[model samples]
Target: MQPSDSQLTGVPQTVIIDPNTGLPQNVVIIQQPSSGPKIIGILIIIFGAITVLSEVISLGNTISFGGLFLVLSAVNVIVGVGYIAGGYMIQA
Candidate 1:
């Protein structure tokens, strides 16, 4: 009979070893996810949502600026969409 390979390490499996026996253990360790990115992503997503929702008010205010107002207001929407995408990308 021959020694088998570890699921994760394949050959010469030295990943999770039993300290007392000094032999590889069939155990897998999973670490908790960091909350930093989640927190930041949520905040950024919220800010993006706010910015997107507030466009109506912003556009109203910019109406007096005449022709350039649409372009300027569109910029705000684009930025808000970018923030939303950035937040999702950060999470990934």
Candidate 2:
């Protein structure tokens, strides 16, 4: 005989069937929600700003390390800005 209309199709045979109705019971599907990326970007920017400020402050103490600090500070700022831009793009 052909399958009845009430019979479940494309459903796993292992599913628990209702005793009275002869159909799957208590089927639940769970899904995770998407989260945005913005806080990380802000943190990166803040860190970069702090590094640059510390480098500037150190410039007054020693001349030998000033060049290295300047380079490091610039790199930090650039990376931080890139992260912020990336976060904005992801949000959009």
Per-candidate local distance difference test = 0.83, 0.63
RMSD in angstroms between candidate 2 and the native structure over all alpha carbons: 8.0
Tell me how far the alpha carbon of residue 18 in candidate 1 is from the true structure, in angstroms, after superposition. Answer: 12
Compose the digit string of candidate 1's lDDT tens values, residues 1-92: 56567545456835877887777865666999898998898889889989989987777678877688788789989999999999988877
lDDT: worst 10-residue window of model 1: 5-14
Q: Ten residues in a row with the worst lDDT in model 2?
A: 33-42
How far is 67's C-alpha from truth in model 1 (Å)? 2.3
Candidate number of the best TM-score: 1
User: Could you tell me the TM-score of candidate 2?
Assistant: 0.37
Summarize candidate 2's per-residue lDDT along 1-92 as a digit string, tens digits: 78899987685657778887776876466877445345665565566566656656766554565777667766765775675566566555
Model 2 ranges off by over 4 Å: 1-33, 36-64
RMSD of 1: 9.1
Q: Candidate 1: list runs displaced more than 4 Å.
A: 1-30
